[model samples]
Target chain A: MRFVLVAGTTETAHIEGISAAGADPALMAHTPSADLEIVEYGQPVQAPVMPVSPTGCPTPAVITRAVHELTEFEILALDAGLVRPTSAPTVALEAMPGRDIRHPRPVDSAADTFEAARQLGRSLPDDELVIGETIPGGTTTALGVLTALGERAVVSSSLPENPLALKREVVDEALAASNLSAGETADEPVKTVRHVGDPVLAAVAGMTIGATTTDTSVTLAGGTQLVAAAALARHAGVDTALSVATTSFIADDETVRMNELANDLSLDVTVTDPGFHHRNHSAMNPYIAGEAKEGVGMGGALALADRAGISMADVREQVVAVYDRLVVDESL
Target chain B: MRFVLVAGTTETAHIEGISAAGADPALMAHTPSADLEIVEYGQPVQAPVMPVSPTGCPTPAVITRAVHELTEFEILALDAGLVRPTSAPTVALEAMPGRDIRHPRPVDSAADTFEAARQLGRSLPDDELVIGETIPGGTTTALGVLTALGERAVVSSSLPENPLALKREVVDEALAASNLSAGETADEPVKTVRHVGDPVLAAVAGMTIGATTTDTSVTLAGGTQLVAAAALARHAGVDTALSVATTSFIADDETVRMNELANDLSLDVTVTDPGFHHRNHSAMNPYIAGEAKEGVGMGGALALADRAGISMADVREQVVAVYDRLVVDESL
Candidate 1:
């Protein structure tokens, strides 16, 4: 089946790095065997500014408009974006100027982007409705949202090496920031999004729930988005068959709190790391590791499996081989 | 970790099904939150066996030993049994007989299994070793081998649902047959295994491979064996740090084609099912789908994203949810 990739500015530079390393070319070459149709979501762009400046936060209106223009393409692949953390904390925001506290780009909240994604989902044909996202500072926001929603979420800055430590720090910070007790909602899931969540997360969550038609499959590309989408699916009460894919590392205890939230929601999840064999050990930064812990593109793979009526093993082999080659190229 | 499951079984009166089911109470009342080490692999047993004549196939000595010693405590937590198929085409024999070949158990041809799994890795740990099987028409020989290998693989026989049409007819024909391929080496995996594959599928494939030490942070669990595993790791001559889990719907194709095949040749391979959701659907049959496809698990999951760590939205969500559930149970 044809597959579309929604590109976001979240880590646009990272995507560029991957492309420059020939990941895209290698992947494109293998398409014949996998029978996948891939298209990027948003046009390539510079990283969005973070912590709105004196110029003011890029208007959400601009983001909305840009997305609208991009949607003009007959087939919208996937929605993704970049994330930048504000220098100050949310509680300290009152003392800072709006420009100082605001993040660059108008879509401040995951909710906004999620809303756009929802609209995109609605716009697609039933069978063509598949969505995904990318946000650089997303893990941090994911922590924010998960904490805000009263669930303990681990947030980490991207490190080229030692991502586990970063993940631990984020999880610790989120746990400390939240007021809710852990495992209190043992019988059911606690409302994870309402507490310390972001706008983009909310938007993706909305899009996933909104696009729950039988024929459509919604994929949340990043670890943070996957957590958000699970919370959304749980809260939205959408029961259409769904799948989530993430890195093998993110399946660890620190990051797995999000998974617990998903179980409460009765969602089927799949964890994967495509380029396991080609991991860049020399460039191993905690931030990168933390991001690697989250991984990406697993959601779409599941959708493909479902659509193709193939087994999970078949898909894993195809993706892993391509991913390994791509990552190896990057290391070089 | 706490895990919840819905138990289903088609065999109980016979030893074959029971051996393959692994643990029951552990599978059922499995609460991830409880102070217990829980792993759910087997489903519950259903009916008693109906008297039937022997299928007259030579069974492995190892399989026979494992079945005769079955007990309640072991039933709570143990590996499932593997059996050889007595009826059905070689391609369609991946699943157990009378189990509605819709969702067949994944099995790999001997060569593929050994090349992709056995020969690919370092020696396995003794403590973690336990075997399981998935071949149809495997019990009788299990009895024979228990008499020979000193293991219990068969206790009783359950008549096939439609004995006259499928199981019985196939068994009787086999009793009168002779020429069959021997050893792991053969030209065609499906054909080789069809002539000789047995309950060893669950045992040898499951036990030996399961004993290896790999990172479980990411696991590839489902369909076939060798190819699925190799695909996940890509066998690129690198030490793999990722954890892989595999499942089989049929025998390994490689094993049937090669001689002097070593078991540890395919460390990169991890087999698993394609459909992780296991949702009940009338339009699809899991077994058929599995046999038609090859390789799965973590490898398949990786294909959904851009090699740079971009994931498909849907795959991310699904994997995250499943992982979240797994983690939550672990914490419990």
Candidate 2:
């Protein structure tokens, strides 16, 4: 089998740790055992080209480009700046009441990205198609989207040590600001997108629904992505597994609230926490720990596992190998 | 934090998948979030280096080299192997007595590689001591070593599907060829390394023991490697945590024979299966299934989890991710 990995942050994609983590499992499994082919999404999205934000979130324009470039991949598609609502709600608003909610330059709205993803899905072979996503700052946005759509969610930062309070505070504030409530069932909640969600969530939701109808498995590889995808799945009435590749930090109590929100949505969710098994001893550094807590595309990883029928142990080992390499690189 | 993986073969090291299959709570508690780290160990020792074997096992040296060369951060140390006896045996000589048994090539020998590992470990900072191994056909050698030293082991495989019969057959053959009975204890098994086990096993044992004494958590990234390291820990009388990473395939075994072996030596054993909660959906190929049936280094992954204090759910998720990627690659 051949895999063409869609790169989201092109510049960071080549970073030794990131590439190693993404590629190791495929390489190991296919090298001597099966005929495996791998191709990375060639487009490069440079990091640090735009100043690093104190919030640690990438700019929206960067995200749009990331998703736009995903057109190159035959299977995988990615957008750095898209997020989804955590739950379903019935409401429609023409625009936010006070927030300017300006569309950043080189604007590619969630709908645009969604269409692109749908087009990518349309181009695939009729066999079981596997679709995954990668987005940074996704979990926080996932929390915003979920709350905006009326699903109570607990957001946890990816810090090495638990940062439950901070995550919860952010989630609560976002929901309050949006005047959103959890446990609401609506025919549609289009307004939530403008108030709390980002473009990635909408794109993934559209892609997932489109792919599932064709009997494909859509895996959201990060915790945040899973939450966004799950909400979209729920909203769209799509029946497919929603897997979340997380760490112990995310799977544990501090993050359980987020999982509970997922459960409430009746989303077929699976969490893959590589940290619980393969501890990245080197990642214990406070700095790296902080980055980990930010939550990468782990939800999509879990979704991939669900589609693949793989056991958790295998996933943990692979993620750990990648994580260990990442930590080592950071130390260097 | 960075790991350089080297794959070795130790067929006798495998144990039944019953523990994971049963989801034994005790075992679950110790499971690592991730388990295996795939990389090349020196060269193919058992199967011929062909594109495809009659048994469908592709014994490709290129695969091994690919794993080794793909490494970007950590230096690849290919040569040393490690395995633990199910029982405390007096000599390593009585462990593996098959026609294929011989000293691992000097470049691939345990003693030489271990010396290098010792130097490497000594040079690195506390966090940079991440180590992994790849020993094909290792479980058999592990059982041979353990049994020669008087340990009772029900060696099994970690094939995607169960291969209990094939695993049993291999175990029976290795035992039949040995001079030691199943229950005889060897007071000094390490000294007899020349008689029973191969070179890589001895070196890994040495490296792990050496790493532990240095005040850092040394993870045995493979099952056989962990088992072998655990045995060394017992011999050395240390109480440090050695992390063992494995997949759900290993955890599926209900017998807990591998755990029993680790416990017998009074070595702290932690088992992690990354497969339990993975999202991958694919059938296990027979050849790879056969290898899994012969058991992979699940014990090692478990040990790593125990030492790391990781949870089962987390480990399962990570393993699932890796397994999904592997399966996806296969289909491609």
Candidate 3:
């Protein structure tokens, strides 16, 4: 199975308290770009920039890297939309960076981006694809897309507190701005994403649609953002063997209860824990404390590692090694 | 096997009589870009622009698309450097378009582009790759690269006449401008490319290095440009299973005598004849007459189709169909 990382940025990430993708909200725009670099190269090429939450939790790319080292899975990164350029080589679709969801049109050129990604999906050599995404404030935009498609989704957040009310308010205002009500866009998937979703949603959903039309099976990998993609794909009439994979942190979150969302979308879901809660590493403590639940294909990577017969202890060790090498060593 | 088209451009192609890729020298810069779009979509997304020779020979991408249809081989496009934006989605490497070979540094960021492509090559899912290229005036640049690496190479030309004297003069002027002599750069492959080669050479050579390090085997698919890449990779100490695949037109070019170059590089070579010389169609005449002889993975695509039990007649039929659909229909 091939692991493809679909990364993008949204203007919604600039809003204070809306995203926990980086330590400083002003620097969140660089989070997805940095995350892709870290996954591809074990560190960012740009000096002294790494994706971290305010609570000191590292980006989920570390987990993905560990899994890659363990299983040797090949990776390909796709740029849905990027505010800043990444050091990693990416298949560019010339997609525009998403606007704030409160804007009537959050994602310009959604249809074009979708069609391009669909063409890409149809040409991929791999028959099985696990598509992961990295975007700050992606869950809030996930909420936006889910609501616009008329789903009552309690999306998971990277933050510990979940910020349900804040997400709800943002989605409500976004729908009102687009002159759309819940369920109004059920039949118009691309239009719904353009109105309220982010570029990653459109790209991931489009790839899934195209891949599934062939012999390829897709595993949408992330938290609620990927859940939103699954919902969008299903609403867009993609019928195939599709599954959602997320970290146990998201599955067990009190506010998320992701299984219900998966069930609502008629999708199968897989949750992976990597045994971080029981580890003694201080760097992993924030994960147990629920700061960075899931964002960058951690769950899908873990599942691949598991299928390869790699132990969670080994994955934790590699994660710690990567953290120390990329994060701790860089700070020093 | 996966087929990847690595495309780029050079200011060298803008030089008079150096390139025959497009109907006008002024328009040659768009030839690679439009070639990629045609290979991906069977037509350029932008109407009224298709890659063709000044003599009305269609781009070799038609042959590549025909092979893709006959064998369902997965295809990917990589942008080594492009003078113009293409309608097809591409894996962007941020490589700079090459300057005239006479410039001291023809390709900026050669090492960086190489490293990036190397990383991408290491991550590709396929076990075998057929890498091709599309660039106007590529043979002249290939002559420049081959000579810098100390090879007594005679590169093929897209034009009916090989233009050997013109290519040698350009290479000599380029070497003089760089204040280097032939064979002086034998030990510094990346530096050699930066001094006189174009972006596609560096990108293709790097990918060959990276892919050959793993279980992946590579076929450098084209005429002498790919032979130059093979030479670059070898001088850079890439010791692995690598071969050059090209059309019979290149193999039969009296000026090129490609077998000698392959023997000097110690690389195995495969030559594919698509039987265009015996075809009845008017469009086949240009190819038989040795204009637009070989490019855009035509050689490797034909090899793959032949292995897949596809007949040359079927391949020719698809090529004509794509030509009519994309070129003939659009013009009318």
Which residue pairs in candidate 3 collide? none
Top of the candidates by lDDT: 3
lDDT of 1 by residue, B1-332 (tens): 10001011222113323221222323211111110111111111011111112321111111111111121011111112212211000111122322211112222233343332332122221222222222233333222222222221122222212122333233223322423312221223332222323323322332234234332122222222322222212222324433333333222333221111113333333443334235332111322333222111123222212222443343334333433343343355
lDDT of 3 by residue, A1-332 (tens): 77889889898888778888998976788888888777766777542377889877888998898788777676778888988866565767647889999999989889998888787677564679999999898999999989888886689888888888998999999999999998899988899889999999999999898888877889998889998999889998987768988888988898977878888888899888888877878668888988888878999998888889999999999998888887564666
lDDT of 2 at A230: 64
* Two-chain DockQ for model 3: 0.11
Stretches > 4 Å off in candidate 2: A1-332, B9-77, B81-99, B102-110, B128-132, B159-189, B236-243, B275-280, B283-332
What is the fnat value (0 to 1) for candidate 1?
0.00
DockQ for model 1 equals 0.01
Runs of candidate 3 with Cα error greater than 4 angstroms are B1-7, B10-78, B83-137, B142-163, B169-197, B201-332
Candidate structures ordered by TM-score, highest first: 3, 2, 1
DockQ of each: 0.01, 0.01, 0.11
Worst 10 residues of 2 chain A by lDDT: A86-95
By summed lDDT, the worst window of 10 consecutive residues in model 2 chain B runs over B85-94
| Per-residue lDDT over A166-208 for candidate 1, one digit per residue giving the tens place of the 0 to 100 score | 4435434444545444433222222343333334455556656
